[model samples]
Target: MDKKAKALELYLEGFKVVEIAKELGVSQPAVTKMLKQFPEYHQEKERRKKENQEKARQWRNEYKKQKREQYDEDYELVLKSHREDAAALSRRGKLSDDILIKLCILNYDYNKEKERLVFNESAGKRPADLPRSVYVHKNVLKQFRIPTRQ
Candidate 1:
């Protein structure tokens, strides 16, 4: 076949004008001129452009879906780790089942804060009629983003 047929074939196969020029050992303007001579050139180019754009959009959507799934998996792992830590505390008699259940709904930050509050209170803070667990429950509700409340 002639250069025109070869150029048209390469163009349909998604090769750029510069690439086609290099492949055919011709100048860029020569390749462009040859491609322009075809009656269907503009329409074919537009169709391929739209097709590539759609493929890119689909790829992006799939990437976002995968990232969302990965995030959910990571979130579950974190919750499981927290539950194990709470269970360890319960087994050691450091936490009651009721308090452990409440703390289970909260993240690590709340647990750390609750521990600090308990330490500060035990180290000679002002006395109160309410128990420490009650204060911790109130703090957990007020401070953290509890899923149940949503």
Candidate 2:
């Protein structure tokens, strides 16, 4: 359960001491103690870990120094490309009447779908002999979360 034991296990498994020290977030001197307790070749792995950490820190600093205008230009390019795509879809007659009908019901983003209203068949006050067809719209039925056996 201790970090020293884990470092020892990792060393025996041929992981570089630099990797062990980096993973355990400990100094080489401390790692040497864990290595001595386990008595394996963990020394080199620790040195490599410090180098890896320095490289990682360098990348993080560079990322933080990135400019806001770089992101703004990316947004402008994406907006221009999307406008062209919409115009193309419109020109090709891809946005037809039937497609528009389905799109308005399903693709109107937020206000698109119907709400569920319960009307159970078995416990109904309706007539005894009824048709077996699905009466509600498929989208409306989905709102009820009903389990259909058929």
Superposed Cα deviation of residue 111, candidate 1 (Å): 30
Worst 10 residues of 2 by lDDT: 107-116
List where candidate 1 sits over 4 angstroms from the true fold.
1-6, 13-15, 85-150
Q: State the C-alpha lDDT per candidate.
A: 0.70, 0.60
Q: lDDT tens string, model 2, 1-150? A: 789889888876767668889989998788877777643443555666788999999998788667566788899999999997697568665654333433333322222233323334454443322222223455653544445586
Residue range 26-139, candidate 1, lDDT tens digits: 999999899999877788888988999999999999999999999999999999999987787777667654554454333223344443223224435433422343334554
Candidate 2 achieves a global lDDT of 0.60
TM-score of 1: 0.49
